[model samples]
Target: MTQEQWTAVDRYFTDLLVPPDPALDAALQTSAAAGLPPHNVSPNQGKLLLLLAQIQRARTILEIGTLGGYSTIWLARALPSDGRLITLEADPKHAEVARANIAGLSDIVDLRLGQALSTLPQIAAEGNSPFDLIFIDADKPNNPHYLAWALKLSRRGSLIIADNVVRNGAVIDQSSSDPSVLGVRRFNELLASEPRVSATAIQTVGSKGYDGFAIAIVTTDQ
Candidate 1:
């Protein structure tokens, strides 16, 4: 009924299903201590990402945001020893904090510091194998751009997930001047017409309040 209730139910389910980890708690603590916006996904959502990666048997992952590395830790743990996860962050302060949070995973975690707009192209230039899973959770205005890059960097069957798509139902306000809301609107429209992937969005409510994520599977190379 209330956001509080939603959050409580989420935490209850998480405590019952997910094992507690001190490192994850430490990541959030360090992020807050560093005065970073607690924009990271909730613990249940992070675990969902990990589960998706595991189900996909993802050997390569590309994450467009790395705020404090909270989700990064979860996703990284889903990878095999030889797998790699590259996360992009624009804020140097956030990246530094994330580096500390995920220090033990340095071998498999590649935290890239810079605007994803620029760094994504660099990743393309390097011409690595297609990513098995791609997660986009960065600046809202660039979501469509991130999705475009996700398509470019993916092969058939690759999973692409975008966070904060519902934006508390603000996505329906076509005239809203809020850049983030407008950006998600544009993205929804784009996804509706994009034929390269079969996509859908799922609305969710939890400790982070109401939001949603878009999950798509690359259906074709086109």
Candidate 2:
């Protein structure tokens, strides 16, 4: 199928399966007002997250970025009553907005204001209690580092989803050498080569653009 065709399919499936939530909508508006980068996952991506979380019955989820808690709300809402999500954001201003936006979800979401690299290692040192789901949407340059950390902390059956894998398919052009594109390409290579995980890249387009993502399921024995 053509790229546009695939995008249409993605839109159709997402629309058919997931509807927007008021809390998430409010959070997106708040993020926009705060002048933060539009880093929050798309609603379709949010639905994919929810579906993956529910599939794993994820009790503990770790997110690398929480722009304004829009995606966090989607993931948290999919969990059981006692399930929890810990999200990291480097920008304190963004974190502030996220905290405010997620105020009503105090029971299930923890917004950590700090570098994800630092936070992730701390979580790893704490016995690496195998996260059921790990979502990476932080600085693109740190994609490889994030994947390594996630692999160390994820269980055998955990799901790891990385956003912006295609980067408008610039990742396929090895000669471009852009940091973000190179980083995403490296991430895809690692996931493809690793015997511990099985993954597939799905091209998607929406408010983001002619881009896509990768969903890797950790399948190795612990």
Candidate 3:
């Protein structure tokens, strides 16, 4: 079907399931007004993340991206009062907008400003390993690196989710020189070869067009 049809279906499902939230709407609006890339997750996708975090009983979360804190709010909502979430953003402008968007969650959400490659190490040094859940959605070229850090920061039973793996079904292109595609390919290969985790990716279509998420559960620390 066409993207229009997919988006229409997404709207129908969202209207039926995902209720309107003033804060979420404002986050989107502010992001657009600030000219940030429209890379935030769709409302339904955000709800899925929320449900997954809740099901995992995640007390600690690590997010590799914080575009405008749209998904951050959704994931943070899944946490208990004492729960904590650390989200990394490299762009100063995006981080500023996200900071405003998630201001209410200042206590629950830690927005780190720096390249994730840099900040992730600091998080580990600070003994923030064994996060209950990790979401990787930053620059695609660094997805493999992010996955490596996710593994280092996770424990057995921890859930790891990576977004934009499908890239409109371009992931299967063996000849693709696109850095994002190459990164996802390597990430998938690593997941397949790594015996410590069991994982799978599912293709999806919605307002964002064809894309998918790679989900994995760390099964062994050995």
Candidate 4:
């Protein structure tokens, strides 16, 4: 009925479905104590990410943003003991907070501190194996560029997800000067034209308000 109602329903269903997650709660508390923005994914969304990784049986995951490593932990926990998740964060302070939050996950979590545009090239140059799943949630202005890199670094059958695509219904305004909206428009066009992946955007509303995420699966024919 309303955003408040939607958010309340999200919390209601989350409590009825997901078991208690003290570690995740602690991570949020620590992040807040460190003065990080309260921009982490809600519990239900985090659980969705965890389940997505599990369903894909992903061994290697690449995340374009590591805001306090909240989502990073959810993805990491979905991996096998030897599975790895590499997250990129441009903010040194956020990266540091993420490192502290993921202290025991050193074996499976790799936090890279630098601009994704720069670090992604290094990863590609290293000739590292392609990530099985990639999550893009960084600066909205660079989403098109990020999608380009995501495609470049992904292998066939890889899953690519980009968050915050629909910012409060602003994505439909083509004439809008908002850089994020313009960037998402360009990114959506690119996704539509690219034959390398099959994708769709799923709109969502809840604690985060109106927004959507784009999910693409790399095709074998690409």
lDDT tens per residue, model 3, 1-222: 999999999999999999999999999999999999999999999999999999999999999999999999999999999999999999999999999999999999999999999999899999987899999999999998999999999999999999999999899999999999999999999999989899999999999989999999999983
Alpha-carbon RMSD, candidate 2:
2.6
Per-residue lDDT of 201 in model 2: 86
Clashes of each: 0, 0, 0, 0
- The whole-model lDDT of each prediction reads 0.93, 0.85, 0.96, 0.91
RMSD for all candidates, in order, please: 0.8, 2.6, 0.6, 1.1
Prediction 3 global C-alpha lDDT: 0.96
Q: Quote model 4's TM-score.
A: 0.97
TM-score of each: 0.98, 0.90, 0.99, 0.97
- List candidate 4 stretches off by more than 4 Å: none
Q: Give the per-residue lDDT digits (tens) of candidate 2, residues 3-67.
A: 67766776787678776667888898988988988867877888878888888889999988888
Cα error, candidate 1, residue 149 (Å): 0.8
State the lDDT of candidate 1 residue by residue for 1-222, as single tens digits: 999899999989889987789999999999999999989999999999999999999999999999999999999999999999999999999999999999999999999999999999999898864999999999998898888899899999999999999999898888899999988888888888988889999999999999999999999964
Top-TM-score structure, candidate number: 3
lDDT of 1 at 126: 88
Judge candidate 2 against the unseen true structure and give its global Cα lDDT, from 0 to 1.
Answer: 0.85
